[model samples]
Target chain A: MSSASPFHGLSAFPATPANIDGRVDTEALGRLLERLCEAGVASIGLLGSTGIYAYLTREERLRAVKAAVECVAGRIPLIVGAGALRTDHAVGLARDAEAAGADALLLAPVSYTPLTQEEAYEHFLAVAKATKLPVCIYNNPGTTHFTFSRELLQRLSDIETIRAVKMPLPVDGDLPGELAALREKTDLAIGYSGDWGAADALLSGADAWYSVVGGLLPRTTLGLAKAAMAGDVDGARRLDKLFAPLWQTFKAFGSIRVVYMLLEHLSLARAELPRPLLPLKSADRQRVLEIVEPLIALEGGRKS
Target chain B: MSSASPFHGLSAFPATPANIDGRVDTEALGRLLERLCEAGVASIGLLGSTGIYAYLTREERLRAVKAAVECVAGRIPLIVGAGALRTDHAVGLARDAEAAGADALLLAPVSYTPLTQEEAYEHFLAVAKATKLPVCIYNNPGTTHFTFSRELLQRLSDIETIRAVKMPLPVDGDLPGELAALREKTDLAIGYSGDWGAADALLSGADAWYSVVGGLLPRTTLGLAKAAMAGDVDGARRLDKLFAPLWQTFKAFGSIRVVYMLLEHLSLARAELPRPLLPLKSADRQRVLEIVEPLIALEGGRKS
Candidate 1:
């Protein structure tokens, strides 16, 4: 099932550190990207949900992409998220990412007015035509609220540059069955993104683990990803157990909130999430500290 | 059940016509506002979902507001939609609308990373505090994806300027029960926005009918609203029947899509919905024309 696509294996999604005023803190972002490169994840998913791509201005997003390209320096493939509410805006973002040296573009049907299947298909086609960079269909319904029907996916797959799909974990919890169904419909490379389900997704032969936790603790997460991808069931489960506590916190408070706290705790970045997304309260922060203390040892596996 | 709140009665939500590149077509927008004024809608709901507030940029939104203020010329109370994905952006919109002479503000908890109840509360509180204008909670889950629990509504009602709520129709269809429950919690003037349910919502003694059809055919919609408000069941039902076919189109295709087509068909504006939202196909356009033909005569009761 191995393929040459960059949307394979573990793709680490790092939080973009930015000031309260929405200015990108590129130096801190570079430190995070540099760690992912040294740790040798398959790809870097920059400006993802955890990266607050929706909250940042276009200027800030461009600045972040420019900085990420310089920091990675082709050490790893960089997949930049280019989602916006309007199609033209998204096309502009796709072009900017391509010109700024993004290896691929991850696009979500980010909607305010919920789109019809035809509208979503047309949007993907427009962005796909905008750049030569391969595009991954970002099917994140939890945030974007636009579900991609298989028919729509099949139609989009016909577009030359739509190379992959990043799917949310299936509600039925049958990763193998969902993967089989999706494979029958389209030739696009398939991956799954809920962090707690990463081991199972990989174990069940998903092409990639679009991971949020891997963004902060790249070395530890990559170890788990490798074990599962290699079908070392016991090894993968053992590492999954180490992450069980963090996953509980992630489930309780969203992964975006937990990841920012982790970045600040590790002193990799002292970034504030854009307002409206407040930092965890003191009691919850203390709880996170307690849960993460034992797992700190696992984060020390960087190549440097 | 009635007060002097501008959120009450038939508050017509007109489309803000904009060019394909997201520029506000101020002259076209002024034409729409002027009609709403001549027809004497209770309040003008500018930059609503129909108005494409979520699609327009800040400068464009402010420009739309300035043009609306000049065109409306204080003939009717003006309630402007001030929704944005980020809280700071929403605050800026609210301030801009206030400075540009809006009579009230409609804020929805528009989200990218779905918000916690507390986060939504704080977001609304910040915007409410930022402006002196009265605020209407825009509880539009179909677009914003943030549903308000009654507890959240109760908490928000405690804010002085938070004077009203524009609710979607309840799933149970028991507008009376829902209204009673909401009324028990707060004094916020409660209105409903799903157009097909407008007759029942007003007939149920709800404070307002936030009508989309009213945006274009103000006299006809206002007649229906007046009948329902005055307890003339026969008159309201008769008027509601005239709109039955149009409501069907709204249900089949969204009200936003249908309304944009109507605006262009009527020669009011040659606006294009910002991209990703394509114009209705020819068959759908023909279907709309046939449905609206009998209804055209009903659009002729303007004051001037």
Candidate 2:
């Protein structure tokens, strides 16, 4: 069931920064990517959920992808998010990503109207047709409100260009069993993204761990992934324990918002969430800091 | 809370037809709007949910708006959908809508990450600042996966440029109670989408009836809305019963897909849905045609 895919190891969903006028802050993003590469992050995902892909205009999104790709300078596998409600736009974005030198395209079934699994399939198929770049299905039902069942994923895996999937943790909380079942069903490279159970998922033979924490804390997150990959469950569990409080805050607030605050607190990226989404409230920010400050201190102050 | 807003009566959420290559079929759209105007639809909404605004590029969307406005020629109130996940993009679209001579802007708080009430407030406020055209909030929880509570609506109504809201049918299916409660809370004009409950929602004193059916079957839908507006409950009920089967099919499939089929069935618009969304399956299409054929016959032969 398992097969080698281009996407493996830590695929950091880097948080996108913006200027006060709502333009993508390419300089800041470039610096952020440079830091991630320096800290040993192997792969970088641009315009991901944490990148506020949904919140940027198509032009802004393209700029972010191009800037990230150029700044990374082939140092890492640059996967660009090309998710859109319409297949045409998704295809257009996929072409844009490929032309901008992205190594792969990450897609999600995002809709204002509920879509069936058949719709999701046609979407990825159309996007895959637009570019030769490998496509990674992003299945985050929490935000998408449309879940791709195992059967649908199995069918999608048959599409030649769809080489991987960044999946959400199951709702029923059966992490190991569900992961095992999906692994058994398909040869698509399986990665898990809902940051909370990442350590466990990676330890259970998941090919990649798409990390929100990796965007800002790449060194530490890379350490955790290394431990899990090495089958050092104790080391991975210890890391998860250390990050438990931060993960709790992420659950309470969103990962993007939390990451923005942490980046600002740590003086990494200029902390701003694209509008229609404000930053965490004062009390919530205080709470997050109480959980995050000690861990940042413990990580020896290396921050992107 | 009904006030004399710019939007009133049967507001048609016209489906946008496109060529197989996915470019907006402006000539076809122009012809459709001409037919709609002739059918006595006093208000035309371009790029509403039925129009597949989410599936279009910014340039494409602007072109659609311009084409609709030119075809409408100030004969009816032309409302354009300006919803986007980013406030900046939403603002840009609103400005474009105003520049293209749309009478008002219909917006939905679309997000990949769910937004808080405070965030939705800032989103609308920023858009309002961009243009003088009146803004109508589109609250469709089914697609957006984010529902606006009554409390949030009350707060939103205070924004000066926020003039109306196009609401979804309530979750509990209590149309009258929800309409009554919303009317009590704010003076902002209220309209309803969700094709299944249009008749009842209009009868309950909703200021506007935003209709997918109205775009194609304008004469008949206008009759239903008129019956409800004129306090002819019996007439409205009769129309609802006739349309019940179609609504049922719409619920099972989406209104956009069903309406595309309906428009194509009657030879009105090109019956195509954008990518990722295929046209209905054969069995479902059969079910819809059975429900729609009789009603189409009853409408006295005015086909677009």
Candidate 3:
């Protein structure tokens, strides 16, 4: 059952494109999904952190999910992020995802209150009860401030619809050891985010790379994941080194801001980020360009 | 003008009690407000962190605010928490709060995407634009995971509607220095939360105590604040010492859970906590009881 999650391999979390007035730009989203599918990425995630789900109203988020499902058109599995601070709202979002034809639901335990493990487990259970779609627990302490303990994760695995887990980079930076420990405890399929640590997690046999970089550089990111998955350690390392500059920009700043900057740099998306979240500063954007421009030239051109 | 903000005093953030089915216990909420007003607390902050605003749906939060306004009956100033992930929704919440007759609004920069200072400013500005009520910036990095910098706070002070700020405990733990510096830069009236640090902050010329304990222990907590505000340093210290044990329990278990437990122990409200956040564990509750029992006795008896 651990190996049975449909969300294995490199999954691209495409940034949600919004118009000047902040409406979801479904036409642009469709184009982005087409590029990802054409690049042979394993799955596509809509409304993840990269998609700015938190900054969109419920109606807008539901609209984006519908558009993503329509655009992906079943070329590959479409995983939709369905997290909210309230359990009832999360359940509502899950049902919406299912109704919109999403293949699976990824949830983060987002809270304004510091959640106890018991509460987080209850949140997942309630949402799972509401939707038949397979659920993937997205553990991102940096953003959500709730780290799902291994024992709790193992407990949650008993829920029939809880099929996978997306882990943050281990706090001690011990990706290999932590992944090994998680694998030992539960049959839950485990993936990892944090673009800086994707190479390490993929090389360490993690099931998926829930990626920000994959959204922009699908072919390149897919190559790296495929190399690591196939045990081509040298190829994976080479790709890691090649992408090091971009990773440095991400680490120095934040992945969300950097990814949005990169998308804007490539002219793939508008520079608009949701309000109360400014775009990367001009100096940081220039620095990122210095890192990415050479790679863009070397790779011939961006897909756009 | 900043010093003239109406939020200067002991403001109790009463927890929003819910029924077995998770509906807001309006009768309990009204009784709690009546108790606080009777005890002569300076203000009432409804739908705050203690109110578990994040766990509530938009409609539920609006309902709670409306009920609180009706209960308070304009007996004292009421500041309602109006925060959301999206600026539009936050503005909507702000409008609802205003329509409900709230005197002011307290907002935390609650975001899934880590916001730049500029983004946070834009968020506040948008909400301020939408409502006539004075806005108090809520800086609880522990929960909201976004801190309002002194520089940004000073900048936001230029917005006429942005009148006050609810600061978290300073990271460096320099209460006097940080508060003085914030005062020097921003004319915004600065208040502080974190019940453990209330004594230091109130004694250091901060204008308000946005208190949790006050909600359940109004007379005793207000006595401490009044003492500090009146420059009775010794009296403030004595109260802080007396409350130290309960504060420690709050730090270890989380204020939300501990406050709910204390409220339950006193029979001030039902023991129900919003889902995904359980009440204090029994052992921790016992430890809290060990610390609080003496104080409860000295207070003569709880309102129950």
Candidate 4:
């Protein structure tokens, strides 16, 4: 059943950055992809919320997707972010990404306003119609503010091209029962985001994962995913303990900004972010590097 | 102090609907525009969240703005919605709206992702820079799940074209306080959306009012605004009471659908929304008519 799914395993949402002039640093992104692919990442998620896409122009985003697709060169599955607040634009990007050779799309639910479940269902349907590739629905109420409900999920599954979901634990409502209910839904793999919850969601039957903190410290998460898959509960528990302290950093203002800062701290991406997203302060940056340096080293040492 | 500011006043988010066949019903919309103009609406908000903009294509939205501009015919200020999720797309729409002779723009912050203040600010600056018109910033967190903090608002106001703010009262948050702080900091007119908090915001020193519910009961809302402006607290309170039951209708799901239904019921405009936002059900249809008929009669009797 899993063999047929477009995304079968761990996916890294590669943090994208710009040069001093604010243009996407394609070369740096290429190096990061090379490292990620060499380290055996199954899929690469560029142009995500972590990728600072909201700041880039449509043309810049299109160029970035093409660049990533060229660099990844089919070494691993590449998922592009093609969602906008409007259906036409979202569908347009979906079609563009397909033509650009993305293996799949990490589509966000409708934004800018609270969407009715029916509208959300239709949004998914429109994107699915736009492209032939697999579509991974992103459900992050912590940011998008609209939760693609289970009813939306069930309805979306009926559409043949929707292949997976990115369920970051909604900060507001209860999703424990929601995740439990997801187990009986379909063959579609559910991926966890926000590393603190990854191990738990895996235990709750999630199949794949989207990691921001994982990029900053990969092996700790990779180990946890491996342990969970192998049913090694103790190993998973230890990794979870290691990740628990680092998770607190994401709870502040501009979580995505923080995610990019963490990535930059590890020399994985550029230090700059697009306008409106303030860069981390020198003191805060130094502190983050100090706190997470050991774990990043752990990931570095584990790399083959 | 206020005279020096380029933006400071009331505004109405005009609903744009087609006929049953999806063609822009200009005659109907013209009448609605005339009615709003007659009501002394400070600026006309075209293609906003209430306008069912997400359902319209780029071509359709541009045409809608063009049509609204022609209909209004310089009778009042035309503030178009340039709030697309992507930077270039939104800037493109902003340019088109400006070219169409729109008086101002109402831009929602970055969509889909809870953009960093810098990203949201940049999105605003890019749109503001795209056109020379005064820009009214729209901060509705209920739909976007992202609030532009007062600090962020200050940053946004730095752009010369960013002249105002249209903040809808957020769901489950202190809107009155938020609006008050924003009002104190900038010379921008702070209009209350959803109208539930309009009276309070006015009492708290808000300069203007905006609402979908008020569009449904313009007489009552206008009466309240007039009364509040005249310091007629008792009279203002009276109109607020009258619109309460009617306000309950727009508070639910398909409120945008219901707005079109009422506009049709009153013969104000056509009863069509763009695709993806379907018409209401048969049973709900009956309930809506039954619920608002008396208020319409009561308001109509007052007019005659």
Candidate 2, number of clashes: 2
Q: For candidate 1, give the lDDT of residue B47.
A: 90
CAPRI grade, predicted model 4: acceptable
Of the candidates numbered 1 and 4, which has the greater TM-score value? 1
User: Candidate 3 vs. truth: CA RMSD?
Assistant: 3.2
Model 2 agreement with the true structure over A157-248: per-residue lDDT tens digits: 99998888988887787878987888788878888997788888888888899989998888888989999989999999998898898998
- Candidate fnat values, all: 0.89, 0.91, 0.77, 0.45
Every candidate's chain B TM-score? 0.97, 0.94, 0.95, 0.88
Candidate 4, position B261, lDDT: 71
State candidate 2's DockQ.
Answer: 0.68
What is the lDDT ranking, best to worst? Answer: 1, 3, 2, 4
| DockQ of every predicted complex | 0.84, 0.68, 0.62, 0.35
In order, candidate lDDTs are: 0.91, 0.83, 0.83, 0.70
Predicted structure with the largest lDDT when compared to the true one:
1
**Predicted candidate 4 versus true structure: per-residue lDDT over B134-191, tens digit per residue:** 8888777775556777788888877887877877765556756676677678767777
- Mind giving the per-residue lDDT tens digits that candidate 4 earns over A1-304? 0123446556777677775445787887787777777766667787888786655656778888888888876577888888676576677788888888888888886455466788788878878987788888888776576766677788787789887888876564344575667756854677878777777767665778787754545556677777876777898898888766567666554456566776555556665765445666788666666766667777764232
Q: How do all models score by TM-score? A: 0.97, 0.92, 0.90, 0.80
Model 4 alpha-carbon miss at residue A151, Å: 3.8
Which of the numbered candidates is closest to the native, going by highest TM-score? Answer: 1
Once superposed on the true structure, which residue ranges of model 3 sit more than 4 Å away at CA? A1-5, A20-22, A261-271, A286-290, A294-304, B1-5, B19-22, B262-271, B283-300
